[model samples]
Target: MKIKDLFKNKEVTLSFEVFPPKTDDGYEAVEKAAARIAELKPDFMSVTYGAGGGTSKNTGNIAADLQDKYGVPVLAHLTCVSSTRDLVREVVKSYREKGIENIMALRGDIPKEGRIAFDYNHATELIYDIKSLDESFCIGGACYPEGHVECERQSEDIIHLKEKVDAGCDFLTTQMFFDNSTLYQFLYRIREKGIEVPVVPGIMPITNKRQVARSVALSGSTIPQKMKIMVDRFADDPEKLKEAGIIYASDQIIDLISNGVSHIHVYSMNKPDIAEGIMRNLSTIIR
Candidate 1:
C-alpha cells in the first residue's frame, strides 16, 4: 500500500520508523526489532537509510523482507546527500524490483569525518528525480514543524516545502515535536502559504532524558515546561522514567488525533518497548 493512498482517505493511521544496523553483529537485533514492530500491525513501517545513503542496501532488504514475508507495507528511506544520479536511479529500480512502492525521500546530513559527495542538496530535487524515475512511487518528504534549522525563517522553510509539494511529493512527514501547539501553529502557517498537502505529525516521546537534550539540540524544537516537570520527577528511576515518557508521548498523540490529525508517525528510534508502550496506550483510542 502506498502511503499516499493511506493518507488520501485521511483516516487515523499509526506508523513506526526503524533503522538498519551498522555492524553484522547488530543486524539480527535490528531485524528482530523490525519484526516485533510489524507484529504490532502499524499501517506501515519505514526503515531509515544511514547518513550519506550508506545503509540504503540494508534499508531495502529490511523493507522488502517485511513486505514480502510479513505482508506489511514497508517504506524505505532514500537519502541523496552523497548518492550520484546513477546511484539514485539504481536504488529506485532496486526498490521496484523488490516490489516496494513507498519511499521517504531525504537529504541526509553530511558526515563530519569523510568526504561528502552528492548530486543533490535539498530533498525536493531528490523528489523530482525520483518521480521522474518511478511515477508510481508514493514519495514522502520531511517538513520541520518549527521551521528547518538551516532556514532563515519559518516563511522561508514553507517556501522550500512548497517546492517539494509542487515536485510531486505525495505526502510530508514532520520532524518530531513534543508540543502540539507548535505543530498546530505550523499547520496554520503552511496552509496560509498555500502548502496544504497532508502532513503526518511526527511524535517523539521523551523515553529517555538524554533523548530530550539531543532532540532539541538537533532540531531546535522547544521542550515544553510540563514535560520538563514530568521528566524531572522520574528522571532518576529507570522503570518509572520509561513509563512516564511513554505516557507523555501518548498524551501528545491523543491530542493530535482529537484535533483531527489522522496520520501520525512515531520516531520510535528502534525501541520496540517505547513504540509498543505508546501503542498500548493508544489501542483504545486508535480503535
Candidate 2:
C-alpha cells in the first residue's frame, strides 16, 4: 500500500521504523525482529539504509521480505550523505523493481569520521532527484518540530521545508518529539507559512533513564521536566522505568489522536516487546 493511501484514510495510523543489520551473524535476529513487528500489522514499516554499502542490500531485501513475503507495505530509506547520484538511482531502481513503492528521501547524517560524499546538502535535493527517477514513488521527507538543531533558526528551517514541498515531496514526517504542545505549536507555525502537508508526528517511548540524554543529543530534541521527573522516579527500577516509558508514549499517542493528529509513528527500535506492548495498550482507543 502506498503511504499516501494510508494518509488519505485520515484514521489514526500507526507505523514502525527499523534498521537492517550490518552483518550476516545478526541477520536472522534482525529478520526475526522485523517479522515480530510485522505481525502487529502496522500501517507500514520502514527499513533504513547505511552510510556503508554493506547494509544497503539488506535494506532492499528486508523491505521486499516485509512487503512481499509478510503481506505488509514497506518503505525503503535512501540517503545522499554517502552515495553518489548514480548509486542513489540504482537503489531507487532496486526498490521499484522489487515492487516497493514508497521511499523516505533524506540527506542522512554524515559519518563522524569524514565529510559528506554526495553533492546534496539537504533532503529536498534528494527528493527532487528521486522524483526525476521515478514519478511513481510516494516520497516522504523529515521535518523537525523544534527546528533542526544544526540549522539554528526555525524560520530558516521552514524556508528550506517550503523548498522541499515545492520540489515534490508527497508528505512530511517529523523528527521524534516529546511534548504535545511542541507539536501543536509547530503545526501552527508551519500552517502560518502555508505548509499544509500532513505532518505525521513521531513518538519515541522513554524506555531507559539514560535514553533521555542519548535522544536529546541525537535528535537535538528537548525532554520536558515533567517527563524527566517520571524517569528519575523510576530510574533505579528497570521494570518500573520500562513500564513508565510505555505509558508515557501511550499517553503521547492518545493525546495526538484526541487532538485530531491522525497519523502517528513509533520508533520501535526493533524491540518486539516495546512495539507489541504499545499496540496492546492503544488497541481500544485506536479501534
Candidate 3:
C-alpha cells in the first residue's frame, strides 16, 4: 500500500521506521526486532537506507520480508548522495521487484571523507530521478521543522521544500523534532508557501542519554526546557529514562493528533520495545 493512501482516511495514521543492520552478521537480530514491531500492526513501516547504500540489499530483503512474512506495508528509503543515477535506478528496480511501492527519498549524510563523485547534490534531483523511473511509486521527501542544519534560513528551506513537492514528491515527513510547537509553526509557514502536501511529523523517542546529543547535533532540533529537565532528572536511570522518553514522545503524538495532524511517524531506531511502548500508550487515540 502506498503511504499516501494511508493518510486519506478520516482517522489518524501512525507509522514506524526500522533500519537494516550494517553487517551481515547483524541482520538476524534486526529482523527479529522488526518482526516484534510488526506485531503492533502499525499503519505502515519504513526501512531506512544505509549510508552510501552499503546495506541496500539488506534494505530490500528486510522490506520484502516485512510485507511478505509479517503483513506490513514497507516504505524502503533510497538515498542519492554518494551514489550515481544508475545506482538509484538499479535500487528502485530491485525494490519494485520485491513488492515495495513506497520510498523515502533522501540526500543522505555526506561521508566522513566528504562528497566524492556524487551524481545528485540535493534530494530534489533524486525525487526527479525516482519519478522519471516510475511514476507509480509513491515518493516521500524529508523536511526540517526547525530548518535544515545546513540551510541558514527557514524561509530558504521552505523554498527548497516547495521545489521538491513540485518535482513529484507524494508526501513529506519531517526530521525528528523534540518540540511540537516548532512543527506547528513550520506547518503554517510551509502552507503559506503553497506546499500543501501531507506532512507527517517525525517523532524520535530518546530512550538513552547518548541519543540526546547525537540527535540534536544531526537535526539541530531544539530540545525544549521541559525535555531537558526530564533528561537531566532521569538520565542516570536507564529504565526510568526509557519510560520518560516514551511518555514524552507519546505526549507529542497525542498533541499532534489533537491539533488535527493525523499522520505521525516515529523514528523507532530499530527498537521494538520503544515502538511497542509508544503504540500501547496511543492504543485508544490512534485506533
Candidate 4:
C-alpha cells in the first residue's frame, strides 16, 4: 500500500526501519531479524540502502520478503549519490517488479574514499528521477529537526527540503531526534513555510553507551541534559541502559502523539528485541 493512502485511512501509524547486511555472510542473521520485526506487524517497514549501495541487492530481497512472505508493506530505500541515472532506474524497476510500492529517496552519505559517481547530487534530483520512471511510487524524503549537518543554517536546509517536496516527495521523514520539542518547532517552521505534507518523526532507541556517540556524531542530534543523566546513571549496566533507552524513546513517541503528530518511524536497525520492546511500550496508544 502507498504510505500516503495509509495516512489518509488511519488516525495513527507506526513503522520500523531495518537495514540490509553489510556482507553476504551475515545475510541470514539480518533477514531473520527483519522477519521477527515484521511479525510485530507495524503499519509498514522500511529497508535501508547500504552505504554506496554495497548491500543494495539484500535491501531489495529483504523488502520483497517483508511484503510477500510476511504480508507487511515495505519501503525500500534508494540512494543516488554513488549511482548513475541508469543504475537508479534499474533499482526502481527492480523494486516495481518485486511489488514494492514505496521508496525513501536519499542523497546518501559520501563514502570515506570519496564519491564514485555524480549522476545525482541532491535528493531532489533522485526524487525527480523516481517520479519520471513511475509516478505511482510513493516517495519519502529525509528532513532534519536540528538542520542538516552539512548545511550551515536550518533555514537553508528547509529551503532545500521544500524543493525536494516540490520535486515529487509524497511525505517527509526526519532524522532521529532525542527531544520532541525540536520536532515541534521544526513542524511549525515547515508548516509556516508552506511544506504541508505529513512529517514522520524518526526515533532511535539508544540501547547502549557506544550508540550514543555514533548516533550523535552521524545525525548531529543534540543529547539533552535529561538524556545525559539517564546515560550516566545506566551506562555501566548493559541491561539497565537498554531498558532506559527504550523508555526514553517510548516517552518521546508518547509526547509526539500527545501533541498530534500521528505518524512515527523508528530506526529499529536489525535488533528485533529492541523493536519488540518499543512495541510493548506503546501497545495501547498505537492501537
Give the winner by lDDT.
4
TM-score of every candidate relative to the true structure: 0.96, 0.97, 0.98, 0.99
Put down candidate 2 lDDT per residue, 171-254, tens digits, no spaces: 888998999999999999988998888888889998898899999999999999989999989999988998889999999999
lDDT of 1 at 182: 92
List model 4 lDDT by residue over 105-157, tens digit each: 99999888999998989999999889989999999999999999999999999
| Candidate 4 clashing pairs, residues 3+ apart or interchain | none
Q: CA lDDT of 80 in candidate 4?
A: 92
Please provide, for model 1 over 152-254, each residue's C-alpha lDDT reduced to its tens digit, 9 standing for 90 to 100: 7888889889998999888889998888999999999899988877899988878677977898888888898998998899888878989998998888898
Worst 10 residues of 1 by lDDT: 109-118
Candidates in order: C-alpha RMSD to true structure: 1.3, 1.2, 0.9, 0.7
Q: How many residue pairs clash in each candidate?
A: 0, 0, 0, 0
Q: After superposition, how far is residue 194 of candidate 3 from its true place, in Å?
A: 0.4
Say which prediction, candidate 1 or candidate 4, comes out ahead on lDDT. 4
Per-residue lDDT of 202 in model 1 = 86
For 128-211, candidate 3 gives per-residue lDDT tens digits of 898889899999999999899889988999999999999999899999988888889999999999998999999999989899
Number of the predicted model whose TM-score against the real structure is largest: 4
TM-score, prediction 4:
0.99
Sorted by lDDT, highest first, which candidate order results?
4, 3, 2, 1
What lDDT is obtained when candidate 4 is compared to the true structure? Answer: 0.94
- Each candidate's lDDT (Cα)? 0.88, 0.88, 0.92, 0.94
